[model samples]
Target chain A: MDTTSTHGASPGAARAALLVLADGRFPAGGHAHSGGAEAAVKAGRIREATDLAAFCRGRLHTSGLTSAALAAAAAAGADPLALDEAADARTPSPALRATARKLGRQLMRAARAAWPCDALDALAAARPRGAHQPVVLGVTARAAGLGPEDAAHCVAYESVGGPATAVVRLLGLDPFEATAVLARLAPELDQVARRAAEAGRRALTEGPGTLPAASAPLLDITAQAHAAWPVRLFAS
Target chain B: MHLDHSHDTTTAVSADAARPDGTRRALRIGLGGPVGSGKTATVAALCRALRDTFSIAVVTNDIYTREDAEFLLRNAVLPPERIQAVETGACPHTAIRDDISANLEAVEDLEDAVGPLDLILVESGGDNLTATFSKGLVDAQVFVIDVAGGDDIPRKGGPGVTTADLLVVNKTDLAPYVGSDLGRMARDAQDQRGELPVAFTSLTSGEGVKPVADWVRARLAAWSA
Candidate 1:
């Protein structure tokens, strides 16, 4: 992803951006969430750090696909509205749709002052239309003048980080251990983002690729169960 | 609206809207607080109080459900299509804060679906004291706390109480029943918010949502002006 600065970009600017985007404390409202790890873990889909890694890998394939598609589209500079619909149509379960929108909304907001891109600001104004996190992530990165590679990395890192952050809270895994797991995943992240950025570049000329039409059935069912509860730890 | 102005950030009206562009980009407001803090009720009451005077749309977040949107739809609080729901998968805050793409899309979609709306209310999913909307998400935000959470909640000052554009201490009607003192709560809130406005309401009794709605109206006027 060539964000390494042959372009006058500095390590300080990158660190500052990371502080705003990666710090979980940036006030875009991430604290209330457990990043779906709680529900997945409760459903017995994950058990240990290995399971956590595996679950993240699966997500990189499925929900991860959903998010990346949107990000890639936005990076190619596609229509945010259409990207949103493509995502909405792809996410069938009402629960997942809501989740996407909520996070999508927060991402848009946080990106506003921090990233300060016209696309991001315009997206902020367009609401009630619904959005996908990937598209917003792409647009935000673009707004910040980060190239496709940086955008891809941000998407992959945040996607991986969300669940890992949740696991630390849910399992009381050592923070250092969690950091180790995340650090280990960096290579895979680079691989995924690099591949995706190429795909994104191709799509820029192709006018955007189609998304997977089917939503995961088991995911919808679990969300339904979680929603009906009167008392629960996670908001979603 | 025509949405004539074009920029990378703004995805203007779809190909079909009749109104001209650059006419009006609706004012957006966000409402947030702990769950059961009367967010829906505030939204519902706002619709009832102000719909006739302004064009409005709603975006409601539910962590794993569309229950808030459904509630509005069932009550016919607004047209079925006007109210949209955002699901925050793990943490409600992430949708509103960390990963807000989806919610932004929803708000924009609602504006596009209707036309030239004057206001949009993004209701955050129930959350803890720390939760607050990103200024990027909404032009202004309303943090909802209630007497039931404890009269001390205001005094315990969190960002929601201290920094939100407006603060609503809901469930004021419960004060007598809960042995809570509303005056003390109001004073504590006043101490925390300084020149910012605060309102007390009992959504159940319909005691005081109008002032909050009016507060919203003023901000919308200020934003659009």
Candidate 2:
């Protein structure tokens, strides 16, 4: 549970690297995904800002927490291959798994170019098709010299940020409102990231199974349905 | 050329002339334009014209549907496996210009699947004049605008019209019916592009794609050289 150990060797430049990795426009193939927002919007689960906020909150606590912990574990120097398997075990839907791998492969390409590291290369060779995206993201953070907390924060933010951005496109919800939804979730994001980082620290000694495995069944169910849509805006 | 010091890694970076295996990658050319400006038609026509001479693959960034990839597939200009479609979320420009990771993946995957390719055509979903491919994504780009879209488009001179390696004024056959001034369009394009080339074509007419195909051949030649 000692999270500070992960940050001991991180340079001050790691902070800027975190910003670069967490930027919405980081070019890691996230734009095409809706984080289940599309399925929720189409099913009438999310109509306006309030519904969107609720959907994001639900996602944040479940899949977001799980993914953040996996990422944090990877960033804290957990075996990426093992963390990838743990991610697959936590993700129930095959469609989501495929999406994660596809995005992971894309991110691997970008990460290798941006920050060349042997760990990233080893994981890439092991899972050329891709490891899960959170696993890849954690390794990417490490390659960029970031800490486990930074990795956790990136995944936590992306969990809500991806859908909020997509909702602006799907429902034509006011961009300001969508952004404000994210702003409102910031404190919760911090808590989740902190918890995820703590779990990641524990996993270094306890094994990857110690990481969070929160599940949002609805998201898993809707993602499969979303993948089958012949005509949809987002890939996931 | 951008150099990578980590040359031992297997990952492919954007616009690298050589592949990870030390072979030359395909010459990637991007086509971008506004909605219904015949970008897909140009791609299909180019595939038909150049497939005999070169190993060609197409990557279509469809904004919503896979219509562009389907069009090429339906036309049978190239085999189905040679074409890859990328969903652009909602913003076609962002996929092409702002963030090109997906497109680059599609391009690299195509090369891996059907490689030793000579040319790879990346067609952007129809977008506004501001849309253009990033330099990191394509070696060159062709911006297609038609006579029907309005003769004034060239005069407007956005990044696509002004800065693309080539400007294609499509649908010349419709000029008479649409009451567009081809001469003025050409002049405006020349004025905007300086010494850069512009091709006028009507895919409905015989050998309409020849001029564009010839331009592509010259580019391919330069690339090979």
Candidate 3:
């Protein structure tokens, strides 16, 4: 499934496109966390707006970027098999990797049911065990007929999905404040999506079987410790 | 690949009444309830009962691991492909109630692969009485409470018990041993639901799921019609 044409949708369709992509109802496992906001809260890392912003921003760049890049590449109609390997290499923490794949498989199940595309099967069958979140996102995006930008934003949204939910639960913050946080951060949405799209293009533009690997040990270490805790509110 | 085309009404052994266009949506039903109240048994039984009636699929939500899906597969309740797991990695309530994206995706994928599906059941992992299926994740929901959980469960008035499309009082066979009166539960349920229906069953003995299945079948008919 090397298909790669997006039909050059009109600008007027952009709003609808964003709506479909950003709609919390898209069903890709974004509801599982508060973007590490829960973990951050547990760690005493967040208590107010400014702290939440920084934590969300950092996560947006790390695991968030890794997953988004892979999804974007997938949306571009790249090989899911290749994307899986690439995503696996970038997610080094065993616990985090496992969580990513768990979410990935769950995401795949929903995406396959909602939109029947060869890419979905390709992704599911690509690996003997489990595929990574980015790969699943990328393949699903393509299957859904979304552009790379939509794929890019979808990935960024995943980062926020979990953390945003955590905030409401953790702080008892009103939903209005949460939306305000998201609205103020809207500028970053375009920026992060653009970068993610570029990263995805780079991963796919490389030779077949070639992929990037995880660079941050801090995340892996934190995930390991987080997993060992007796009680944790988030998966990782 | 529209949602309306019906094709696998008879031939497809995997799913008895799947739609024709493989690229369509799965019919989603949700099972939610309190902890240790036979939610797993209900899910396994539904898979067995409906596996031949539709292209059946399941998504299990365990708090920390993919245990429930593993349990069903280990018991051979459904094929490995037909069973997937979602580790909520959080409160079980969050996945089913507040945030439902992951569960929704699983339902869609099952439909995508062996679809157009007749049904896909999302099993909520054991949790407190507050757990209920999100409207986005399921077309209709079955709230499973059991005699073991106590007859007061009916009067507890959680959204799951009062508002779910169908309410199931499981483990009726254990009522005598557990000292629960099914008649009292019926009265309490009636007091809360007004017109919504409730069925009492003992999954351990396979005593009462037929009515639940019939209700589900009727919903599927309406969805496809």
Candidate 4:
């Protein structure tokens, strides 16, 4: 598990390592979040597979693209602190920011243990609370011998995967249907990942401001509302 | 087979009880079992019995609410600052076993809030027999099942029944009233977990939590050794 390589290895080797990093069961605390699906379900905006697909598609281009770019930038060896600030700026909702940091801290814990990198050590010390999550994910992907494209793919998949799984729990929708929704969106996910990775590569020269600032106003508002709820299944 | 009780707060995913500076951290013990099986009661009892001798904190994983954590706080089992609740998003088992990131965060938060504590008891929300804590989250575990749930629970041995570090058959006073067979339960537990200790407790009784508390003391002693 020599994770120090910046350029990583062959495509086949990269895929195998990516599988481990992108696994849904990576123990990164993504399970407890609905990524706005819970609020959507409660608001009657998302009821079945069709609504779920639309919701995921909307998220993919908006906050999902933003997160993917941040991750890809980190994987591309961008400064995590600057990327973290970029994350905070892109995330308007204070509640979402808190959720990002909390999940960031949790992911950092798992990544530090799994990869044991010095770069993770410095970030953990600097942000004892946590940096933004996608930054950590990108940095973790880098430490795991993955590249910007790999990190982008991981973020893109997570963006929709979390909401789809959460809908299954929230609506009791068929597990097969939920999985099919993800499968249906796979092509779009790939496109988003590629664009995100490209943007990340450009950010190295153009600056962090060159990154996408796509926002979903509804999601930001709903996430804030969801945080105040006294009783809810998912955290956000 | 002496365990490395050292918990590195920085790189820990599971039960790393040593802070990065080499000083020993708290011994984390998990209590898990079926819904309504007195897991919360046993945790409260353990806190009551051990708080005098050990500086302690508690982390509770609740399915939908912080009821378990609130119970401890209401009872003053430990101070409010010493208690933390992890919302499990309706999956207690996932938080404790499959992906323990939230629980790890809660435990570490408790340690950070409180001082260099001697013990931290992590109580799982009432879950089925199949639920158990991951080794990454707790130093040791106690599977708590009430005799009232069924004496057959031990006989129908699942992972928690067969392999927990300690199996606590709680609410023994209700055994006769509920028509549960205590002797048979004891025998079945013995068969399921050979050489591992089992404690039968009625927390209402004065000395009921002593045996489990003694076991915890021994574990703490060994951890500090």
Cα lDDT of model 2 by residue, B77-127, tens digit: 999999999988888898888879889988888888888799999999999
Candidate 4 C-alpha lDDT tens digits along A24-82: 99988999999999999999999999999999999999999999999999888888999
* Clashes, model 3: 22
Please provide, for model 1 over B1-225, each residue's C-alpha lDDT reduced to its tens digit, 9 standing for 90 to 100.
Answer: 323333443333222122235455677788999888889989999998889999899998886467788889888979988888765654677667655655666776687788569988999989998998765467788999888888899999998999998899888888888888898988998898898888888776764678898798788778767
- Per-model B-chain TM-score: 0.89, 0.95, 0.86, 0.93
Counting clashing residue pairs in each candidate, in order, gives: 58, 0, 22, 6
Number of the top candidate by TM-score? Answer: 2
Rate residue A162 of model 4 by lDDT.
93
DockQ of every candidate: 0.14, 0.49, 0.20, 0.43
Residue-wise C-alpha lDDT for candidate 3, range B1-225, written one tens digit per residue: 213322222211112233333433567788888877777888887778777877778888887566777789888988898887765746687788765656655665576666656778888988877788877567788988989888898998878888988999988999999899999999999998889999888776665577677887888889778
**Which runs in model 2 stand beyond 4 Å of their true positions?**
A1-13, B1-7
At residue A236, what lDDT does model 3 achieve? 61
Over the true interface residues, superposed, what is the Cα RMSD of model 3? 8.3
TM-score winner between candidates 2 and 3: 2
Cα-based lDDT for every prediction: 0.71, 0.90, 0.70, 0.88
Tell me each candidate's TM-score: 0.66, 0.95, 0.63, 0.94
Please give the lDDT score at residue A153 for candidate 1. 69
* Ranked candidates (lDDT, high to low): 2, 4, 1, 3
- lDDT for each residue of candidate 1 in A25-62, tens digit (9 for 90 to 100): 65554554555677787877777788788767666656
Candidate 1 off by > 4 Å: A1-43, A57-159, A166-176, A187-236, B1-20, B97-100, B206-208, B220-225
What TM-score would you give candidate 3 relative to the actual structure?
0.63
Put down candidate 3 lDDT per residue, A57-82, tens digits, no spaces: 77776677667777777777676776
Per DockQ, what order, best first?
2, 4, 3, 1
